[model samples]
Target: MMKFKFFLLQALLSSSLACAGVMGDKPETETPNRLFFAGLGGSYNSVKLDQYFNPLIGTTNIYNGGTLVAFGTANGPAVPFHTTQTTFAPEAQLGYLQSFSNQDWLWGIKLAYNYLSITMTDSDLVSPQLGTLTAVTGAGTGFTGRATISSIQTRIEHEFDLMGIIQHSFKNIHAYLGLGPTTFGTRTNIYNVTGFADIDGTHVDVSGTPVNFASTKWVWGGVVELGMTYFFNPTWFLDINYRYALSPHNKTNYTSAFAGTLANGYTKSGTLFGTTNQYITVQGLTFTINKVFDFV
Candidate 1:
């Protein structure tokens, strides 16, 4: 789904540019051209995370009758997790802008980087029988299996992209479209879990259970951008733009190595994977003052 959305947007951008190029309108290319440029800016970004957990050691579904809880509904146990966060971060871009000697079309190669932090939490009530793998207990055992669990996750990432952009100038302003491949270095920290559960007639407090240690992954994605730039003068200009990025789903398996103890002293671990195409789309508002060197 994410990949499809990204490609769809790309195709739209391409079609628009192709049609514009066919109009046979020639732009004035007599203004000073920028040969190289660099910029620093601030970005207000929104990060949304979608997480899925599956216990590879046992049955994946553990709710009664194998039905998981529905979101915002009084359905069953094993509530779903969803979170969104807004962050303020800094970004930097360095690139070379090229122009034909007698044309108003501009092309450039740019390298950019963004750094951001995200923190979120999810909590729910789980049936104690969930601890019993493949066997349903607590019936006639005088013990009701019930517990409350909450998880807090913190993550930080450095994202980089190398892109190619094409722009068409009109007087003092120009509109541009860019597409490129991006790479992300992400680090995630899992804190101790908080909850309680009943196991085989015994009640145990599930607190500070080591669910996960710190982990990191390097992943790849793609980005598409649309924006307009206005020049106050040949050497200085203001740029405003919006971008959408899509990353492939990242999959990781949790073993005993990065596990912590559960409520009943059982090892806490699960196989985690990104569902729904595991991607991030950032809506950013950027303000930049740039200085361009004229080779002429």
Candidate 2:
């Protein structure tokens, strides 16, 4: 009976030792769900501006050297002009992350905002007909007049994206690819002036009134990303990603109103119509610190 009791004690001790060794050799597994994240980054954005105006024609009578000269209806270009500008913009995003049962595949949706601005100026002689008339004083001498134009535009983009993501993990480092659909709410304001007469400081007011216009539009787009994450622990990580996004053409209509009397005492009051169709593409490298929590 004594020998049997001693053998039972030895077996129990050997089994406990084996269990400890097995537990020590195995690695700890992470929970399948990561709940929320907030990120900040910089985006390189390109805004394309396509502006076209309808033909503006009018007449004014100016007295030069005590004689009245009549300037008849004149025409401007009907074709639109296009310009592009790039800006380094700051962007912020907030969203929740959802994981699949497989854990290797996940999905997320986020709201992001970016602010951008662009300004361009174009100066040309008022229609050649008008320029030639302005050049001739009542004396028919070579008194030249010229027209100048300047435009300032500001725009903001609010975006939302639904993403499909795949991730591969090696210890604490994880790499991921994300593909998604992006939607944008864009708002823009434009201020412009054409026909400033600065020919030798004579300050002729032949130009149209200063124009203030605003428009808002919605656009559909797509975005893709490749990223890597380094985990500081189970709940904190640093992530860096390269992202690209593009949208189709979207149209905006601008209506401008100007009121002022011309140098010839003619009330230059009227409305001019302009239209723009714009396409935008953006690419950037982003760095973020992500905090993940378990779903309650």
Candidate 3:
């Protein structure tokens, strides 16, 4: 996906350069007022390292009250959920515009909806994994163990962006830029997680139960955009846009189950879980046919 986005960006640049060469030094186009525009485009998005993140379980303190080994916090190698995802997203936009000054500087705001989805599986193995648990007075002090982790974590991002727009025109062409805050109506699912611990120890379990890892409410981010439109007439145009958005997730939430057996045949089962975050950034290129209704 990285290679693909890079190539597509190169192509867009080439096309823009070619257009510039052909349209060389043409007189600037007339400015219009009271305009409404709508557009639809397709984009490709790929994600890399998170700005802020936590593994599924991050506690590793192995001693409880200075006596017992807290097995859950004994994690060594954390789960690798940093897998990359490539998404071909579809987006739609609506905006209203007018000339902001005699200089033909146009100012407006745009609202857009984008579908950015991701899904992946990750695993980790922690041997001699040990943690902090309440000491059962008579359970004996030598609590040591190993654990393995497996899970399928999914992220589906539905984004709505409201950006302020500014644009200037060249003969038969308009170049524009937009900036704004973005909101994510995202959903995450964590399923099929499993773990194994020491024979004489209890393992932490969260995968046995399916849970929603991310919520659909209140994930905020930001975006910057640059685009060009080639006017075929007064009301119709073909546009190509490049957008970059940064989404920083605050935290993750989920419920987990803990169940394991001791070498002495006693059964142990209870609770343990933690929060995490996967902040993602994406760059996209899109092409759309747009229509403008002008009131000049």
Alpha-carbon RMSD of each model: 16.3, 10.7, 12.1
lDDT of 2 at 206: 58
Can you rank all candidates by TM-score, best first? 3, 1, 2
TM-score of 3: 0.70
The runs of at least 3 residues in candidate 1 whose Cα sits more than 4 Å from the true structure, single-residue gaps closed, are 1-34, 56-78, 123-150, 193-211, 257-278
lDDT tens digits, residues 1-296, model 2? 99999999999999999999999897754533666777676667665555444343333444444454534223343345566777776777676666667666556655555555444332331322233334234432222333223443435356555666677666567787878887666766555544433334575555465555677677788888888877777677777777777776666665554445666464444344455566666666767776766576
Q: Which candidate, 2 or 3, has the higher lDDT?
A: 3
Ranking by lDDT: 3, 2, 1
- Which residue runs of candidate 2 sit more than 4 Å off their true CA positions? 1-31, 41-89, 115-148, 157-171, 181-189, 192-208, 216-220, 257-270
Report backbone clashes per prediction.
Answer: 1, 0, 6
**On residues 1-296, what C-alpha lDDT tens digit does candidate 1 reach at each position?**
99999999999999999888876575533436656777788777776666543322221222333333211101113444456788887888877777767457889887777787665555442423343323233232222333233453536477787889998888678788889998767655434423343545566443334344356777688888787878777777777777776566655543322224543334443322211123444556666667777785
TM-score of each: 0.63, 0.57, 0.70
| Winner on TM-score (1 vs 2) | 1
- lDDT values for all models: 0.57, 0.58, 0.62
Among the numbered candidates, top TM-score falls to 3
Full-model lDDT, candidate 1: 0.57
